[model samples]
Target: MIIPDAESIAQARSIVLAALSEAHAKHAGRGFDPYEFGADVSPLVNAYAALTILEKEEPSELAEESSPED
Candidate 1:
């Protein structure tokens, strides 16, 4: 299994956040596409939720990697 580097993880989060923001805009526009929301957005929402839970439960462990090493 391959581990993700910091840049990789950050890029992933950025992508997910951008997608979710677009979804939110779609939601605000009163246009909901079930197929697109399900096929495209569901997994990203789940992933972001999971990451949030992890951050809450293991803040230190997650933050450790972001710290500079000497």
Candidate 2:
């Protein structure tokens, strides 16, 4: 039963995205193909997916919906 706080989840999302971006940059240098690092980077894909679910379920900001008069 691991419950993460909102702040922690947000921080994790940011860190994961940053790490993925850095990893991609490293893979692109010296003619290195991304496929060669698929195994190592695949977990990031899952992280993105998990974050998406969390974001949708627990959005940081919610817009108020206006109701039309009948």
Candidate 3:
């Protein structure tokens, strides 16, 4: 029952994407093959993933579609 402060849709999307990307890198690096043209002893496919990872973990509430007006 983790009640994360209700974030906007965009914010939630960012979190999921970041987690998936990390899992891929750790898995991908394990699968690296030096014989291949694009390979490495400690491979990395973060290719702009660092750039893509949202600077803000939570986006502004303004991203919300609609909310009950007080």
Q: Which candidate is the best by TM-score?
A: 2
Among residues 3 or more apart in sequence or in different chains, the pairs in candidate 3 whose N, CA or C atoms overlap within 3 Å are none
Q: Is candidate 2 or candidate 3 better by TM-score?
A: 2
After aligning candidate 3 to the native by TM-score, how far in Å is the CA of 53 from where it should be? 22
For candidate 3, write residues 1-70 as lDDT tens digits: 2223434434665665676577667657788444552443222335334333434334444344234466
- The per-model lDDT (C-alpha) reads 0.70, 0.72, 0.46
- Supply candidate 3's per-residue lDDT for 7: 45
Write one digit per residue (lDDT tens) for candidate 2, span 1-70.
Answer: 3445677888998999898888888887757775776866789979988877766763323221233347
TM-score of each: 0.52, 0.64, 0.35
Estimate candidate 3's alpha-carbon lDDT, on a 0 to 1 scale. Answer: 0.46
After superposing candidate 2 on the true structure, give the runs of residues whose Cα lies further than 4 Å from its correct spot: 58-70
Give the lDDT ranking, best first.
Answer: 2, 1, 3
Residue-level error in angstroms, candidate 2, position 33: 1.5
Output the lDDT of residue 1, model 2: 30
RMSD of each: 7.5, 8.4, 9.7
* Higher-ranked by TM-score: 1 or 2: 2
lDDT of 3 at 11: 67
